[model samples]
Target chain A: MSEPPQEQPRPEAEIDTPPRGLPQPEPAAQPPVPAADSGAAPGPGAGAAPVWGAGPPAPPTPQRRRASTVHVLQVIALVVGLVGTGWISSEHFRTVWLGSERDEPVAVDGAGAATHEGLTVSLVEATDLGATPSLPGTDWQPPSGFHAWRVVLDAESTNPDLFACDVALVDGGGRHFVANLFVDSFVDGFEWTFSCGVPEPDDDVPAQQALLVLVPADAEPTAVEITSTGFSSGYIELEID
Target chain B: MRRRWMIVGLAALAVVLGIATNVADARLLPYGPTSSTGAIGEDAGAYPFTVHVSQAQAAHTVLVCCRFETPPPTGTDGVWVVVTLSYATADRPRGASGTGLVLRSADGREFPVSNRTGSGGWLAGPDIWVRGDLAFEVAPDALEGLTLVFDPGIQLYGPMPTQYARIPLDLDPGAVLDVIELSEEQILGAGER
Candidate 1:
């Protein structure tokens, strides 16, 4: 009844193209139905809804727009806000409880020396500074009920890069004391050298590194320890006479 | 269903974040030195040092603390409270925080040493008790149940509590005098102790 369909007459593969010599059909794939011809039917599947080119091919969807500068900036800000706050909070908690502090140290007797990172520290002598010892005109002095003592150390090294160390006196009671840094001046060669003989660049460490410390009257210090403040925990414990 | 789930997820996230913030502020945020409280004449021990508050006094005219009279009659109406204390450290307090003394009253009023001459913040090595005086200016009525607080001056990175010596001071407001001389910080030598 629908005048034998034009494309249906052709083979399946050749439906897309007809011979050029053949008379040309209307421009569109299917002719539009007139409003007056309401009784006319479309393709086989066409009933309440008539789909165009539903069997052979479908129309291409419109391309989507690209992301905008504002959208990208919003994403970046969100990531930064979340990551920054999380990192700070976690970092604060992480630093609170350090797992360990001291490590097994290398022990050396009197007249012996220890070295780390190319720098060497040695104990030369231990002298007793009697009760009532005072470095007059200096900001530092021995407190009451304590005896002052001097631990002489000699240091030698050619390297000063990232160099920091602490030399402390240990009493028989396990008390530790380092040379006081607040001493304004060196009175009468009474030096409390906390440097542990760290020499200046290209210069020799002073011959005698006098480390003065105050020990309690009950127990006198029998040894001294040297440690680097950096990551490496390797240390030296030198005995005193 | 999906929309309801999204709302529930967002609400859960909000509650979690609220709890996290509260916990962080209460335990994590504060770091550095620790502190504590004590009474006069008693030995209080803290990290890096041990302290004892020996004496406390109040005066209007303080001797050897920058000026002869703390507050000139023309100046603010306040009284001078001087504290004498000593502390010993087995460890070096190098570059540590809180060397000066602070005066805290019963009602939570705090006053620090104002005058620079012979002021607070003296430290020494182990076995040696470093004796010093710290003077503060406070209202005449604020002298009741005064306490001297000393922060052991530890500025460590962790949440290590700073050792604080809060030794209560007893003074008679009526006993306020016109002149008082402050003692110099002295390292107790043999007989000097």
Candidate 2:
């Protein structure tokens, strides 16, 4: 074999000389050996400047700043949403539990007057008209299975205009009875009108009317309820004897 | 920029939720007028019979159109309004008795049927078709927005609920109401015309 080719000396500049105007990297006593599989390009930080040695770290990225801001806003929104939900729940609970109790009806005696919606209602007397009640105009006859009761009342409306009211008799068993219009025509002692308007307040005269209610012979009325046609909540109840 | 977009999306969602809540309340709540006034001749009854308004006339003195065993009562001060109602039904046969009729004015004043007048023929019957007139005495000034109200005599142990049909009157409030003389033919042919 021809004598092996003699090794040539490498240029000095390629080995140790640094580029102009850049700081020289401190050389290690034993240079790091590249791996056998290392590709043509250098790996990260292999030939690049070290983090501590890099020029005043690159300014924070816009994308990163935006992400941090969104995170803070999300935390704030969650707190607000939680607080609002709590407030609404508490308010609803307070109304349902506390408001209804205050509106319960108070009881009053038969002769006593109960006031509601600026109107006063008093029951003067209640009489059980036994079977064979007298007819007002000889035209109609009382139907079978029915009993009649004469109810006298005094009512006055404080409203400027006339007020119409509904008068009903409630039996002890929670059954309702409307006044008999047929008998109502003949009874003369009543001062108040049923479907008709109740007179406005007059200092000299009290508005009084009588109504006749017919019910099944078995009904035993325990109370009388009077209210405006449209206003159901505003009412007065009188306990009957 | 992302934070702003998130806030905008949240606001849009909140507005949508608020609107939905209000819509639900209006439909589900039991408040407000349950029924509105219908045109003349429309079936306005929630019960078995269908009621129709044929004609409404105002007069100072009303002639009792239908013959009764006892003559009807007369009005004293205000003008009388005679309302002719026609009742008919095909499938559901119902009879109405003691219908509490009243006239309500714009000022909240109510004029009940003159107990002294009007025929009770249409009050209770199983007949498929019946026509009758109801009279109310109301002040002339109370004519604007005059509405005829019919109560379906509901017997209750407690206070009466607000349930009734309202029929609007079509007469002019300011015009003079002449004396109306109903011939036997006019009185008998109430719903026909």
Candidate 3:
């Protein structure tokens, strides 16, 4: 028979400390066994193997690193694409189709006062010139001694009409210098030209206001009786020169 | 599925860019250039009479005639006239070659005309007038300067010029015409002179 079991515990066993007033715990130890006898239980060499976070630092896996790099590259490409598209769109609008042409009313003091027997005259304002008939990209330059201006006339029923514009040289003077201008009449409408006086010693005759009148071969147009011209119902561009 | 979406997005972007580029180019193009193949005259059946472009050149000279049953009016606003030119592009022409208009008398003398005018009323007669640099034709590989000559005395409402003719133009040798068109309109609210 086995010797009677000793009731006293061994003194070599140790207990963990109880910090301050915490309870003490007994040391727990696992028993080591041979693999063959322990039914494939962990042997001495098995438990020594390392886990992912418990070994020497390892370089990132090829699969993970490749995935991260691809994601970062894709993000960079997206940002660049957005920026490039935005830049191109902005350039197109800012430098291309957007145009700056404006029509303002200019008063031509006296447009059709001269009435030579053979000459018939009418007046038209050069506002909205962009809408007039002409070769694209053409610009009008005033003739020498002409100040640029526009007029409104009574072209209510005139055809084959030629345009002549004038402004008073002296305040309240009866004589007016004609502006170098021309307009052609067609069934649809009309377009005209006006000269801003030449550069040197420019005529500084201030127009009393913008004015227009129509003169037929037989009729002499006066400043006050002038009515209106095409499209520009009552617009004018007066130059004081 | 994500890759397909990305491809579609890129394609859409490409299309947008193409359209924008086209619009930009159009904006930069010049205005209407004068034409070369058309003629300016009355509709064959509209007026009691008809007008023809008898000649054109650096100084265009057209023949006037009355081709109708009723005679042209001899009063004001009875006849209106103008000369129109055609070009390849509608753009501002270049140089001092773009100025000057003069009405020539039967005597072959030229009068400096300030601008286009409305005769107090239409007058009837087969008369010729001349306008310069005011008309031009811009064609590929060539810029044609033109002068339009017509009868300013005939009214648009009353009658057409009495003589039949062709527009005489002073153009370079071997230069051919492209197109030109012309018409007349009654003044708003105005009676025939």
Best by DockQ: 1
What are the iRMS values of all candidates? 3.9, 13.8, 18.8
**Candidate No. with top TM-score:** 1
Write model 1 residue lDDT over B2-27, tens digit each, in one string: 76997999899999999986676445
Expressed as tens digits, the lDDT of each residue in B118-191 for candidate 3 is 21112121111111223232222221333333322323222212221223333453433332222222221112
lDDT per residue (tens digit) for residues A1-241 in model 1: 5587665644656446544454444638755554235576553433533322234334543432233555688789989999998878666456644545547666554458876666667888877777566656555555555666777877776555535467777876566766544333366555644454346667544666676666666666778887766525577788875
For all candidates, what are the clash counts? 12, 7, 88
Show the lowest summed lDDT stretch of 10 residues, model 1 chain B: B91-100
Q: Ten consecutive residues with minimal summed lDDT in candidate 3 chain A? A: A179-188
Greater-lDDT candidate between 2 and 3 = 2
Per-residue error at B162 for model 1, in Å? Answer: 4.6
* TM-score order of candidates, top first: 1, 2, 3
Q: Estimate each model's TM-score.
A: 0.57, 0.34, 0.25
Error of 3 at B158 (Å): 47
Candidate 1 wrong stretches, greater than 4 Å: A1-93, A96-111, A132-144, A161-166, A180-206, A227-235, B1-37, B65-77, B90-100, B153-163, B189-193
Prediction 3 TM-score vs. true: 0.25
- Model 3, residue A28: distance off in Å is 37
- Model 2 accuracy (lDDT, Cα): 0.59
